[model samples]
Target: MGLSAFQMVYWKACHLPVEMKHKALWALKFLNFDPHETQTKRRNQLLELEEMQLHAYDSSRSYKEKVKLYHDRKLVKIVFNLRQQVLLFNSRLKLFPRKLKSKWLGPFGIKRVFPNGAVELENPNDDGQQQSWVVNGERLKHYLGGEVERFSKVMMLVDP
Candidate 1:
């Protein structure tokens, strides 16, 4: 038969009376403790810990929002249109690069512009590969110069 008590007690210490008596006698001393009071103290401590966790979470969320707002404010909004010429920034040059080497890759023509800041560029040199590739608008800058002939003109120095 199972026994129920108003307060929690270890079954080995209370249910088996013979063993408990033997242990108590061997110890030569017994101390009184209130189980209900111990449980209440633990419950109160748990409630306090939960409240502290909730407060920490709220503070962390507000801090993240503030950081995001600051970052958004600092970001520049880049705009591009179809058929516009632009230079692509080369970001993969990592080794001991030459100081005079140009970092910009292309004067590629814009084929299409997406609403989400992605721009499709047209390949001017027909390499028989993919005609277009999509790149982030932030990596492109406006090309201002006009088309110049690749052949160089030799001028004779004349003295009269």
Candidate 2:
């Protein structure tokens, strides 16, 4: 005579008397008991739960990767060549500044371009003053001036 799984669990939880524990084994003998089948069913259920958890984790990771790719695609690429004039975004400007003030501060000429995204800027008005700044390309944009259109010479006769 052997104890059924449920009786064994109850006996372990309550710490029943030795005589009471022995009586449950007599009841188990009256009913057919299969320990191998019960253990196999529990193992199968654990494997199923583990597989479901792994699938959920994979789906969550893939969704995050797709969202990141979408955001990356929407970003505009900014590149500055040598001698190109561009406006720099002034991030340090106060929240309540003058109404007439502009946040973008420079029409500075790009004196030199570095491979690692650093640019050397020179003010055309100042003869010898130049500043070297290591900044991301996102903080700059191309500057179009009316001086280029106004100063261009129109020649009627061409010498080929």
Candidate 3:
């Protein structure tokens, strides 16, 4: 069984230091956490962030928002021996929608990039075959959400 949203809220309230627990509770509510199930979402998001764009939006309006929300009284700090890195972006999470939870997924096990302009990825699944792909630098940029010129220029420098 997974941790109920209510149980998570209670746990936060019960164990966290007095002032900060409230903040932690707020974050939990915002994220719709179901403790055990919650792990998978963060795990996937971390995987996605590794090579994709990530933005952590602030609650306030601005030309740019990064880590902008401030809930001074309640901040929860728990550390994980995480295998993946997390990036955060704020988007609509409702449909009954919910706010886009703040977190990015990855560092998706990148094994190598070859001098000859091949981008290699460790098998993304349990497929068990190391993937060595040969492609143009232009495609690499697209796969990585960057400009073709950017990858091409870097490719030149890395070669010689």
Most lDDT-accurate candidate: 1
Quick one: ranking by lDDT, best first?
A: 1, 2, 3
| Least accurate 10 contiguous residues by lDDT in model 3 | 84-93
Question: Model 1, range 1-160, lDDT digits (tens) per residue?
Answer: 4655622454552447888777776665454545577689999999999999999999999999999999999998878878988877766543547677666665778999998888887764344553677778888889887652221111110111
Assess candidate 2 and give its lDDT. Answer: 0.66
Q: How far is 133's C-alpha from truth in model 2 (Å)?
A: 1.7
Which structure is stronger by TM-score: 1 or 2?
1
Better of 1 and 3 by lDDT: 1
Model 2: colliding residue pairs: none
- Candidate 2 displacement at residue 143 in angstroms: 1.1
Query: What are the models' TM-scores?
Result: 0.64, 0.58, 0.18
Worst 10 residues of 2 by lDDT: 150-159
